[model samples]
Target: MRKMIHSKVVFSPEDLIVVAGISLQMAYKIIKELNHELEEINKKEKKNYIIFRAKIWRKFFRERYYDEKFLTINDLEKKFKIKEWEAKEIRSTIKKELVAKGFKFIKGRIPEKAVLEKIYDYSEEERKNENVSKIVKF
Candidate 1:
């Protein structure tokens, strides 16, 4: 009987065919291309996020305090205790966002007299409906 010793770096004849391999240059190129694509995607995502955030902010503000009489920048600053620049930015962002969302926000002065009444009426109706639902559930 003859004994054969196999080296640690043993390979079959098929191993000489050399399967697919990537060089350093090709790897760098692929990485650079991926990075470029990621940057472009991030820019687009940022723009979309800004546009969506603006729309949401406008909607929430309007729902909470939609004044037909648009609040002036100064009034907004004072009311929110923010800087004049911030107020301007908020108004601009809101206007642009609302326009994008197809909500035409026109600047007009409405009488304050009926606003309070309307708000009270809306609240009362909401409360009544809530109570009715609670009773029905009970």
Candidate 2:
């Protein structure tokens, strides 16, 4: 006699809620939104299943959350190529500057535009130093 074993691959909405740190209602709402998007794609491409894959959900979440205006610590580290402590220091410095300029600083997120501007200024300084070194060598 031969026995058959079946594997199930399921990602419940609750799992999405937990992973996304959103409410149960929000999880269902996001699922509905994803389903609608999938349906549109399926209709356009004539695909069979109008289902949401885990990979698709992750992409959607990242796109919705991590945009130019708002960035997490990981984004800062990757963009600035800095250690975690350095990233925190940069964030703190920027926040203080913004507060001094009458802007309110939010916790746990840094403004991407401000961080990018700082990075650009730092790069420009480095380029100037390199040019000065070349002139001194000559």
Candidate 3:
């Protein structure tokens, strides 16, 4: 995958054909349906639109579908390249603090914000802090 999921990640019409292997007509129809649904979802934004915001068209299908937002200590250790004990400690610390911040989770699962904030630093503009992040599978 050339693209990684982000706050504003979306695909283009050409992406549908090349990546998804759908017909051009089907792509257009799908785009129409997606736009209609998105408009309904963001009704306020649809009403008074921001011209520079490129609201013309895009395929934002991840948030609605792919949801693997939590990870275990083992998962964190492997993904973040940290020691198992460190991962355990970090998860322990984050879990305690997150309870006050309205974050709920299972016994060994922690939110991916553990990946987002603690591991990979995200800026105010939704971009990564330094170079490329490990989220991209090379």
Query: Model 1, stretches more than 4 Å misplaced?
Result: 1-67, 107-138
Q: Model 1, range 1-138, lDDT digits (tens) per residue?
A: 322322223211121111102244443443344345445656977533222211122222233223223455665666658897876666666666445654433242111212333324455467799999999999
lDDT tens digits, residues 1-138, model 2?
Answer: 322212123334665444444466665766676667767878999976537543234444444433225556787888768899998888888777766775533346766766876767555467799999999999
Candidate 1 C-alpha error for residue 111, in Å: 14
Query: How well does model 1 score by local distance difference test?
Result: 0.40
Tens digits of per-residue lDDT for model 3, 1-138:
443423234555555444334466755665665566566767855564222122223324333312235577777888878899998888887777767665444456666655466556563345553234546645
Candidate 1 versus the native: TM-score? Answer: 0.30
List candidate 2 stretches off by more than 4 Å.
1-68, 122-138
Model 3: lDDT of residue 77: 84
Whole-model lDDT values for every prediction: 0.40, 0.60, 0.54
